[model samples]
Target chain A: MQKSTQAGFWKKNQRALAPWFFMAPGIIMFLVYVIYPIFQSIGISFYEWDGLGPKTYVGLQNYRDLLDDDSFYTSLKNNVIWLVLYLLAIPAGLAVALFLNQTVAGIRLYKSLFFFPFVISQVVVGLIFTWFYAPGFGILPHVINFFTGTPTAILADDKYATYGVIAAGLWPQTAYCMILYLTGLNNISPDQVEAARMDNAKGWSMLWHIIIPQLRPATFIALVVTVIGALRSFDLISVMTVGGPFGSTRVLSYFMYEQSLSEYGTAMGYGAAIAVVLFAIMLVFISLFIVRMLSQERNA
Target chain B: MFPKPIAQSGPWTQRAYKTLLPIALVLWLLPLIGIAITSIRPGSDLASGNYFGMPSGFAGWENYSSVFKNSNIGYYILNSFRVTIPTVIGAVGLSCLTGYALAVYKFKGNLAVFFMFVAGNFVPFQILAIPVRDLTLHMGLYNTMTGLVLFHIAFQTGFCTLFMRNFMKALPFALIESARVEGVSEFRIFWHIILPLVRPAMAALAVLIFTFIWNDYFWATVMAQSVDVRPVTAGMNELKGQYKVAWELISAAAIVAALPPVAMFFLMQKHFIAGLTLGATKG
Candidate 1:
């Protein structure tokens, strides 16, 4: 009688239980690979070890060492520069989107062709830009030479290397932003646009007072993705300069990898410390994003 | 429509606009065009400083073939497919269930769990790299395609869950409610009723994930080390080190490596754009 009653109980609550069962593999895998690793990295940051040796509890030495580290500051500064310059993509993209938002023949093809850069791998983007910035044969150098009578190897110079890499990154990022804005523009109500036109709104005033307000959601998403992409800027730095020209191009992501994994960089603990700092910074923005998304969810 | 279509302009202005379109496109694609020409140019042209000029002879076949023959590019391409395909399938399949659960049921932690996935998806990868690599090494899966695929599936789940949950929430609840009223089980409702309805969302996510995994360079470098398992992104980097001055061959290989994601984007442009601009259109 007990067994039959238990089976009956199982049959009744099975719907609620089944979701947990279905969610098991994904959640478990995510916890192990993504969630658990976050704490593990935090723990590792407190230790002193060259990945192969016994880990010694160094208690905050890594943090203390980071205080005096010059490269860390340079990387942080370059990251700030990257963040600031990368934002230009949003406005530039919106401009392009507005330019292309018309009923011209084959405009769809034109827009897609413009967006071609974003779809290609960053490795290729890096290569293309590296080629473009190559000294004599590169187009940029020739243009500079034509103006100044001297060719410049931008990537080989410490002062300009980071900016050069950032430019390469902006090419694709701008395309991505443009596509987002184009889609956002597509859904704008034409009746509202006509209503505004009847009110004598035109050109920049129309965009600012009428159109910009409507594009708030797209702007928010653009800002979120752009910030994340800027912080995670590693592949371009790796391919274009390898954080070179005396490490002027180093960003936090590349620097972390260098310290943790490279032959000359066996300081695993120090690397983890850097990683933790980056995570903390990202967490601040992520928290804001979550709060905003939650408010949206509540409203919905 | 937002800019007021150019056709609404006077005829002279419209004629000028028509003439300017091709010119603007050429300027926009100039760098890519240069690269394409350079890729097909003979080695003699680059050596002789004839970069922008027409190639004296087209060596496209030779350069492209040499990239395949002289390097492990074939193996690298295969590795990319192996990593990308499984990741898309795993992440999408898992999210379909998680999404369905969150959308159909009113659990206590639903919003919190949903937000966690959304937040996790946007975090920097470095935060997860060290420990993920360590864990992979501990599991004896490091430097293996299986290790990379597993991590990708897990990490990608965060993004996939956000997308899937949003999509599933947009679905009508009446269908599920009616099915339940007819005495259908939740599992059967998901499998028989909800799954088919979300096929477009699944396709969108699949193509997006495929492009993302295929283009991933950082994790591929972090997890896999051996040429036997390295994907094209890392492989191309290695080839760059070896063939430093072989611009023709290097450019050919780079273009070849970039083709899959580019092709996927063009083929699924509508769904891809829809997925990317999900929240952008709505007020």
Candidate 2:
């Protein structure tokens, strides 16, 4: 009798219970690793602690210190520079995609080769650029020297260091956006293009009115990723300059890592504070993307 | 079609376009081409200030072998595979379940749950880094490959779930309804029906995650310390420091470190692009 009753309960509840069961492991893992850590980091920011020490409550002192620190402002300014310059990848990517959109022999190989930088690790990209800008032996510096009668080591100078890293970063980022646009182009309605052509639309006007509108979805994604990439610009900085040349290349992400983990110091609370600020900035973008995706889901 | 299909243009225009394509590609890949050449150039060529000149002789074997002989790079790359493969399987496997639940079920808070994953996917690693490190240390998993793998799997599930959920959503809902009418259990329906259909997505997710985790540097540095567990990206930095002046060897090591993902991209070009351009069209 009890066995039958238990079976009845199972049969009745299984439909409802099934989804939760499927979702449980993923949710729990995400909560543990990704979600909960967010709040914990926020909590840690309010306390003073070296990585190895006991915590003491110190409300807003880190943020207060940030206000007075020049490095903080420098990092913030560089992040703004990164965000603005990174969006150039979208238009640049579209240009490359258009250039390679032709149906020539071996164009498939050429397209993939053009997308090669994005496939390789950024660490490798950074190293490649490092070798390219290594002063006397580096190619770019030599070219500049030929033009100006003085070799300029771009990564070593304060004014050009951030720009140099951004340029290296743009190589892979532009490739990423190019692939996105390529896929978008492949999916575009050929009839629409033919119609536009029949109307004598050619050159910049056709691209502006027809092709650009069609690539909206690709452009949206390109913007999201490029923005995120700019804000998360750590690997290139870490690999290329290690936030050096008088700390001119420091961004918020690298600054946080340097504060908490590097040999210079291990101020965990301060690092958490920096991370919280970064998170707050990212949250704004995250919310915007999520809302857009939510609307798309509803329409779908 | 947009550019009026070069075949319709004059022969001179077509010839100009054909000539321009290779030139543009060459210029675009100049840095990488430089690195590849430097990797194979004889050390004496560099020493003799012949950096840009044609190579004196092929030293690819010597430079690549010396990188292996002089450092723990081989072990580091092995550790990378150890961390990356398991992450791909775990993240993709777990997401297959979560994605199905969210996509097929009309439960309350489904949108909220889905958005949570999406938002979590985009947050900066810095926010999670300190606490995740703390958690790993407390669990005595720090400096272990398992620690890195576990964290990667958990974190990647966010992105994987977003991908899988969207993919599964595009499937025919009638299949599930018909199965329900036949009294098929939900688990069996997912296993016997949905799983087979999503193989393309699984392939796509697998290659993408493999590359992401393989190329990962931040977590490798934060979570693993000892050379035994450090993956190649972090190890590449260490190798760079060790090989400060050996541009040839450093270039070789960088190429070796980047080889697997590049090979994977070429091998799985179709699914890789499909995965990357997931929401770049239609929605």
Which has the greatest TM-score?
2
Task: State candidate 2's DockQ.
Answer: 0.86
**Residues B71-161, candidate 2, lDDT per residue (tens digit)?**
9999999999999999999999999999999999998899999988988999999999988998899999989988899999999999999
- What's the TM-score of chain A alone for every prediction? 0.97, 0.98
Show model 1 residue runs off by greater than 4 Å.
Answer: A1-3
Model 1 agreement with the true structure over A257-288: per-residue lDDT tens digits: 89997658788899999999888888888888
Q: Quick one: best DockQ, which candidate?
A: 2
Candidate 2 residue-wise lDDT, A186-233, digit = tens:
888999999888899989999999999999999999999999999999
Write down the C-alpha DockQ for each prediction.
0.77, 0.86
Q: Please give the clash total of every predicted structure, in order.
A: 0, 0
- TM-score per model (chain B): 0.98, 0.99
* Candidate 1's iRMSD: 1.2
